[model samples]
Target: MALLDAQAIHPITLPDGTVYRDTVYLKNVIDHPRMEIGNFSYYTHSGRREDTALILAPYLGHACRERLVIGKFVQIARGSYFITSSANHPMAGFTTYPFRIFKPETFGYKDLPIKDTIVDHDVWIGQNAAIMPGVHIGSGAIVAAASVVTRDVPPYAVVGGNPASIIRMRYSSDVIDELLGLAWWDWPLDRIEANLPALSSGDMTALRRA
Candidate 1:
C-alpha cells in the first residue's frame, strides 16, 4: 500500500499463483523523504540476508541519502544495489581518509554533492548491478547483471559491464517513440487487464485502439 519501509522482502501471490512483487523496501535505507517507488516493483534483500558468513556482503541502498525515484513496471532483480553520492568520498585530499566522518565538527551529509537517481518506466536492472547516484535511466532501458552503471542510460538501451555502456537499443527510434506514446504502464488497472492480450502480443494496432 506504500513505498517499502524497514519491513522488506514481502511477496504476494496472485490467484494464478504468480509472484506479484517481492519489494516495497525503498524507504528503509534511503534517508530522503522524496524518494518514491511504484506498483509491482521488486526491490529488496534476497537470500543474502542470512548469509552472515560472506565477507562484506552487499546490500541495497548502501550509500543512499537522497532522492531515488523508481517508475512503474520497473523490475529490479535480486541482489541489485544502488550506490548513492554519499559513497563518493573525497579522494582528492592529501590523504584519502574521510576525516570528517570521524570528526563531528565537519561531519554532515553535505560533504558530497547529492544527485537524484531516477529509473524510468519499464526498466529492468539485473541482479547485482550497481546504479551509481546521479544516474538518470531512461524509460525501457535494461541494465545487465552485475554491471556497474556510471552514467545516464538512454531509453530502451541494453547496457552491461562495469561502468555500464550502451550495448544496443531495444528497438528502432520510431517504434520506441510509439511505445513511449502508448505508455501503457500509466493506464488504469482495469484498462491494463482488459488490454493485457494486446500488450503481451506487442500488437501496435491493438495498443493504438486501446
Candidate 2:
C-alpha cells in the first residue's frame, strides 16, 4: 500500500477528543474535531512536523505550516525547528504596512518564491536543529544538534553547526549506495515485521537478499 493510504488507517486522538488521521488537512483547511497527523509522525509544542514517517523523540515543536513534508523512518530529536515559510518585506521604496496590498509584481516579492522543504527517508535531525526554507535533506542524512541548515544536504552525510557544514558521512559511499538499493522502507509492514529478527541481527547481506 502507499504510505498515505497506510497512514489513513490509524487515527490519533488529541486531548479534546479531536482525531488526527494524518496531515491530509494540510491539503486544504478543515474544521474537524481532531488534528490529522500522519503515520509514524511526531510533533511537539514548538511547531515541528515529523510526519511522512515515524517520529521517535519528544520535545519537538509544532510544524511550521502543515505543509512540512518529512520522509519515512525519520528521527527528529527534541527542540528541533523546521521552518517552511518566511515573511517577506518590501524591497522597493514604498510603505511596509498592509503588505498584501503590494503584490509580488509591485515589489521584489516575485524574486522570492515559496519553496517547500523536504526531508527524505531515513533522516536523523538532532536536537535543537533548525531547518530553513527551500532546503532538501537527502535520504539517510544526519543533522547535528543546534545546527542551522542553510543549504541542501547530501545523502548519508553528517552535518553540524550554525551554518551547517558536512562533518563526515555516516557510512561509506558504497554502503550508502547499497542501503539505498535495499529500499527496506518499501517492504510491506507485515513482511518486515516477520523478518524483524534477521534485520536486527546486523546482517545487511541477509536484509539485502530478502
TM-score winner among the candidates? 1
Residues 1-210, model 2: lDDT tens digits: 322344342324678988654323221222122123223444332232334222311212233232456666666666676665434344455765546536765532434456667887767788889888678898889999899999999998999998999999977888888878876666777777666777668577777667
Writing each residue's lDDT as its tens digit, candidate 1 over 145-209 gives 99999999999899999889999998899989998988888887677878888977878788899
Q: How accurate is candidate 1 locally (lDDT)?
A: 0.70
- Superposed on all Cα atoms, model 1 deviates from the true structure by an RMSD in Å of 5.6
Instruction: List clash counts for every candidate, in order.
Output: 2, 17
lDDT of each: 0.70, 0.61
- Please provide TM-scores, in order, for all candidate models, with all chains considered together: 0.77, 0.62
Name the runs in model 1 displaced over 4 angstroms.
1-34, 47-65, 109-111
RMSD from true fold, candidate 2: 8.1
Q: Positional deviation of 69 in candidate 2, in angstroms?
A: 2.0
Pairs that clash in candidate 1? 4-24, 4-25
